[model samples]
Target chain A: SQQGEEDPQALSIQEGENATMNCSYKTSINNLQWYRQNSGRGLVHLILIRSNEREKHSGRLRVTLDTSKKSSSLLITASRAADTASYFCATPYVISYGKLTFGQGTILTVHP
Target chain B: EPEVTQTPSHQVTQMGQEVILRCVPISNHLYFYWYRQILGQKVEFLVSFYNNEISEKSEIFDDQFSVERPDGSNFTLKIRSTKLEDSAMYFCASRGRLRDSYEQYFGPGTRLTVT
Candidate 1:
């Protein structure tokens, strides 16, 4: 079964605006990571936030994890048309090593 | 920037026929994984391999599904008999040594169409 479930099935915003996507999971995790997919081709790794971490940033992408709530959120600042794609949050099953459960994902569209 | 790569960008096969999806991971990576995404669906994990053995797999990976690392860098997933429901985009991924990080590099998926 899918462990994580992303909110906002789809979102549209103008370039230069900020986009936020949230994900909720059901189990304990060593870490949570975010990925982006373009037209269902391949998933591009975005950022990872360990269980002990509350927030992390990479370039314009900011991610936050609230293990207590078993949720995470990804925020893209100053979005660009190129940022348009499906974003997913993934987590490793508590007991399974290397196996990741992916979320449904959120489709973000940035209009220039 | 080394990346994982899969061959036969797309494959069309008849139901009941066998199919093998091949992948070449980054030379220095050790962990290999197979995932699939059905049309308009989220990506699902199939299996993860390490040390020439299956480390983990999801319920979706049944007896009909098998994974192999034929050689050092080439990893393959084979389906004993294709089913119409098996049609999906298959992706191969790999990550470097454990000490590096948990980041995985995914290859361009191979679209499998079982008719």
Candidate 2:
């Protein structure tokens, strides 16, 4: 199974600033997903990019995947206080076949 | 919008006790899953169920854990004789059937505190 590891274990940025986090994984993957979890709560799926795709966008969020580096990056533009949450990158693998393996996560704190 | 719902948002039990976490996935979804997140750690997949059977499970899922679709809408995960290490938040998720594309919807987790 592929295990995604997010860089900058913790990040703090001012509201309206852009925040970027990187994730690297072990083994090959079918797709990579990004999710956000509020403190002590369930996770909300943000975006997903397949192995063949390079970049994807949803509103203010942009995700880029570099297969050769076996890594992916998530960039949140013009962040807000509501964006304060743990951002996790997950890679789907065949071991648990289609099950997602998540990263330790980047605890993002956006200050107003 | 449809959302997955879980029961008993929080549970407190003693070691060696039995616990059953219930989840009501989105009405039209076909795939269900269980995952756990220990404090200050990553989310871990426990099991995934489809067609009333476990399609896959993680090493963390041992004999003590079992899952069943007791009815059409409810999915349950039973942990027998829970250990202190069982303290974590358990999340239930569902996904519509898609061979090439899969987007899972997760329910608010149940925080289990094993005392």
Candidate 3:
């Protein structure tokens, strides 16, 4: 079973609008990371937030982690057409699933 | 700029045949993993290898699945007899030793189509 589940399986917005996606997990984690895939070819790591940290940012991406809620959200500000892709939240496992368990992902489409 | 590399960008095989997916992880990385995603689905973890052995795996990983580090830098996932359901994109990932933070780097996936 996947450890994380993200709400809003799909999203569409204008290029300049902000896109927000949420991820909820069921277990303790070493860290939570977000990745973007363009057409399912490869996954590009975006940002990783440790359990202790509430928030993190890289470029226009902002990620928040609420351990108490076992959930996280990724916000892409001032989005571009290039940001259109599938976004996934991965929970780095600590026990049986030691690699990274991924969520179903949100298919985000950024329009011009 | 180090990255994980996967070979045979795509492969087609018949059912009941064995398939091996190859990967070359970052030179200094100590942990390696294999994952797959069926069409229009999320990537799922298959297995993770560390210390030259299987460290972890998902329920999706059954008797048909096995992982090995054939050499110092090469990691491989072997499917004893692939079923049609096995058709998916397989990805390889690696991260440096635990002391270096264990942030995984992923590779371009190899698309396998079982005919």
Question: Which candidate number has the best TM-score?
Answer: 2
Q: For candidate 2, list the clashing residue pairs, or say none.
A: none
**How close is every model to the real structure, measured as TM-score?**
0.97, 0.97, 0.94
Ranking by lDDT: 2, 1, 3
For candidate 2, what is the TM-score? 0.97
lDDT of 3 by residue, B1-115 (tens): 8888998899899999999999999998888889999998878888888888888888999999988887798899888998999999999998777753746789998999998
Q: Candidate 1, after superposition: displacement of residue A58 in Å? A: 0.6
Q: Can you give the lDDT of residue B21 in candidate 3?
A: 92
Question: i-RMS values of the candidates, in order?
Answer: 0.9, 1.2, 1.8
Model 2: residues with Cα > 4 Å off, grouped in runs = none
**Candidate 2 chain A, which ten residues in sequence have the lowest lDDT sum?**
A91-100
**Residue range A1-112, candidate 2, lDDT tens digits:** 4785798899999999999999999888778999999999999999999888999999999999999999999999999999999999988774454688899999999999
Chain B TM-score for all candidates, comma-separated: 0.97, 0.97, 0.95
Q: Estimate, for each residue in B4-57, the C-alpha lDDT of model 1 and write its tens digit.
A: 999889999999999999999999988889999999987889999988999989
Q: Candidate 3 has which clashing residue pairs, if any?
A: none
What's the lDDT for residue A48 in model 3? 89
Instruction: Name the lDDT value of residue A87 in candidate 2.
Output: 94
Model 1 / residue B64 / CA error / Å:
1.6
